[model samples]
Target: MKKMIILFSALLVLSASGNQTKAEQKADVSNISSANINQTIEILSTSNADKSLVEKGVKHAANLWRASDGTEEEFTAFCKENFITDQAEKELVFEKISRNIEIITGHFNKITLDLLEPVHLNTFEQHPIDNAFGAYSVDSHWMNDFYQNKIAFIIALNFPAFSLGEKEANAKNWTRQEWAYARLGDYFTARVPAELLQEVGKMAANTDVYIMDYNIYVGHLTDAKGNRFFPEDKVLLSHWNLRDELKANYANKNDGLEKQKMIYQVMQRIISQEIPEKVINKGDVEWDPYTNMVYQNGKTIDATPEPNERYQQILNNFHANKAMDAYYTDQNTFIKRQYDGAKEISAEATEKIFTDFMRSEETVKVGKLIQKRLGRKLQPFDIWYDGFKARSGMDESKLDAQTRELYPNAAALEANLPNLLVKLGYDEERAQWLGDHIAVDPARGSGHAWGGAAKGQKAHLRTRIGAKGMDYKGYNIAVHEFGHNVEQTISLYDVDNFVMNGVPNTAFTEALAFIFQKRDMLLLGITDDSPQKDALKKLDLFWSAYEIMGVSVLDIRMWKWLYANPEADAAQLRDATMQIAKEVWNEFYAPVYGVKDQTILAIYSHMLNSPLYLSNYAFGNVIEFQLEEQLKGKSFPAEVDRIFKQGRLTPNQWMVEATGNDLSAQPLLKAAKEALEELK
Candidate 1:
């Protein structure tokens, strides 16, 4: 599932202007000193309340107060006035805040979904006004409004914010209500300007539009010798469809290698901004990605390369995020916020996990096994080798024909949702309930699952469905997104706390999606009974983990470079990104592929739009492996319900509860090694 846009409810709430330095951005009036907090606690402590409760409430409120909020005296006054000392009253306050936030956030999410329909769904012809409305964030001023009403300060006063470190160390003892309170405390930690928040949302929407429309007329692509390989009517969106197309070609018997090489070249052109500007989303031109040449109506013409537009998108996101850094006193950089706040995993820990797996000897073995299976030396693009997949050996055309016939349109797939779930071991009633909660739609771009924020609101499963039918590739992606819908429904409707409505992060959802994706064939009534199936599954997962971990490292390094060179322009960023990709590839992938300095790692579209999200795929794979182990001899529906309903725990804690192990590559690595030995 694609990560949803950062909700306006989650925007920064600090008082600093965008231009202020980090030091200058510190809370002026709200910065309550330890002495002041102690004095306030003493003053507030009376026969009605315990000193500890007063201290917790005062300290928490003081920590959350901002200069723009009011004077120090006002902060004290607000805390004393709003703090709920009586146990029954405090419980009531917590319930009110939780219920109110759910209503507010849920409505805002629904509004955004409805407004973006033109852009996100293919229900109608999109207009300029649609894009404008899609980009407009309804919740942009929500934080500001809450602060103005003093509601933010009240919540902050009652529910103290917990650091990630504190959560990790202490949350094992926390009740569901306590966890909800901590999440409430998380609401007002930053004080970014509303306009800046709006700008960021607009920038993301613009980027989404760009990525969605970036389709390549695969049929129109020509070779240096003026030969076209793909079907005349076929179109592939970058880099999702393009990458999947390359994977699909593993079953092609004629010129498959050439097609893969051509696709790799096209990816390189995209990454380096060397692709002809006219070739993108346009079939009027036929181009050779290798020779950097274009032709129209059987005549060659000079064409300008895309003018670093790809890098500019990245730079725009960087600047928008950077502008708010001063307001995030605790997690200042976007990198910090993404890991510590959004991912709830430290950067150091995530990096260590990714690097450890990528550098493992098991990865080397897997690469060698893949090369042996291919009966050729490894190319950088072999990172996507699909030979291990059972579907790779089947004719893609036959599968496409089958899928197209079964799902002739979006409605066909939507109608079959319950059947799909039932095939995966869900009972008839449960499957119907899940299906009812998830609405399927034709996507304008590659498909994604947009989860609903409130109960009774349907989570949308969007996938590309052609006029003729949903093809095999689209079907595969749809099933994956369907998994997200399942998890979304369970996590939201069944969870004990409203604040904890999703998984720990996108990765956990991705893991469930993978589980669903791997069963697409079963859903289609196609079964693979090969004895080597289990081993192949392990090897495939291992290889995928290896490939994405390298890309994740490159993504991390690219962002780090951007932070270091804040003044760098698009062209400069492009150079740095390519260099970072190569460096990461050489260090990790080169030893296995025996190919050095490949820029293929930089070709993921998520790096440009999602920002540091590639790591989640690698993490998801590791978690999926652990979950797969736990699911052995277990009920699929029961396990899924039990696990997903554990909602929004820290990743490691969730892992331990679900799998009786921490998130680690070791399980996957060990399984892959054993699989390789069996295959040998």
Candidate 2:
């Protein structure tokens, strides 16, 4: 997941007018008419300096100026007083605002991080009060307060927001400072109320807590005969750990297929919300996922199925985001805000990218290769096929043992960060410096990296650590999160402009994480001397991309389904989501996997919590492949440092600068084709 601060930033801003009462509508409308805008523009034009920028700024300010802000005359006067036309003075003002905003937002981020500690980290026992604290958004009122004091008006007047098209079209020739100006201009695009922002924040926090706390006691899972299939103490979180465990079982010759099948059944129950309520996060009860039966003390008992809580949570999110529709006249729907506003990539373009990749012949070809390797017909769960990875053939238990012994806890991993970076080609001093800026925490959920909001604050790397130690899966995920920390630290501390810190989007960060994750074996000092290593890596990237692209497209379709049926209750939403999942599967995946109507695509927990985020993983795979191609013969550390420091350009511009080409799936597809031929 991206930083919570960054995610909430998406929910805070929306432009124009929508469904409201007459009085409310009047308040939302800009009292500044065209006459006021023209007058302000004319007054500012006397300087003959930054002529186009000044005009754009004035119009933008007028559009956002509300009746609550000031009268038309006062609006015009404020713009005339605040508009900075002198080049040097404007730059200086930008710098000061940039520095101060960083301080304000950074401290706000720290407050949230501190408040959510009990909920997000394993530092202490969770309590109801902690949830309240976690959900209490301190910065929710910041924008509203700014608007009341006309600070937002000043910024909007001086630095107007740019459309994605405008930034992309002109970014190639722009300097770093110009890019920073564009980003600063993006600060205040709309004026959502503090109440609406607070409501969304509470919904998001609650949903996240639900997801993180959802644990499935796999050890208690039984077959039809009440036979246990996993270790007695084994437990896995829904979706992430379960999926990883399924992937890990490929090396278990004794019962790998059966385990995968069992996990697949468990996932089906979760998506359909047919799993017993007592079994969730409860180790005291035993359940047969295949039969959907619950047992206590070896006696069968009537158990209630989860009462559509999963669906209700997502519906709650929909309603929370939907309430903001009246405020966002330009991008009315939450879907539009998520894609175009937050991800800065249009939903249509993102969907096209995934669908195009899915339709490629290489996808089916790779499925056939996996079937050949497995010596069985492909199952729906084969989407997680792990044979292409370098470590696939190695014993997973041995890897787990090694990882546990190598790093027994979060502190161990924290101390070893510099060593891992040094192995990846960083010098000792630089590695130590980078490590010092990153903090490690035991995550309550699977794992995620939280980037620092300011220069001095540390980026947090969080992963699950057990009583024994960090397992191979946790270590692998931690390494990925560490990659995010590396990028986060570098981008924040190394970028030329404060406002330009961080990558263009979460996909760019995920790209770096994937890049680091692929080198897990090397980081463990395990060398792959296989001549086919390069080809295998290509196939792995291709297959992973193919799998997630389908899920991402499914996510998009589910949201589209919800929009079409906005009055949908939880049960109705469940049925429609299942139908949409089947439709997507049958269209894109059935031929490849030789299966029809699989709801596994709906199994991602992200669909319920992080709306419209699955596409980033798909895009990350593409960007990672492109960057890997770029890094083939270059200095690893130097290239990564230089590329990440480019910071927050549009997707294509960032790709072109980093890899000498635009972001596309073609490179991965082309490589996978060659890999299949070579392996054959």
Best by lDDT: 2
Tell me the tens digit of each residue's lDDT in model 2 across 498-604: 78888887889999999999999999999999999899999998889988998898888888888788778999999988998999999899989887989999999
Give lDDT for model 2: 0.86
For candidate 2, the C-alpha RMSD (Å) to the true structure equals 2.2
User: Which regions of candidate 1 deviate over 4 angstroms?
Assistant: 5-9, 12-34, 45-56
Alpha-carbon lDDT of model 1: 0.83
Whole-model lDDT per candidate: 0.83, 0.86
- Measured with C-alpha atoms, the lDDT of residue 51 in candidate 2 is 76
Output the worst ten-in-a-row residue range by lDDT, candidate 1: 12-21
Candidate 1 at 378: error in angstroms?
0.9
**Per-prediction tally of clashes:** 7, 0
Residue 419 of candidate 2: its Cα lDDT?
99
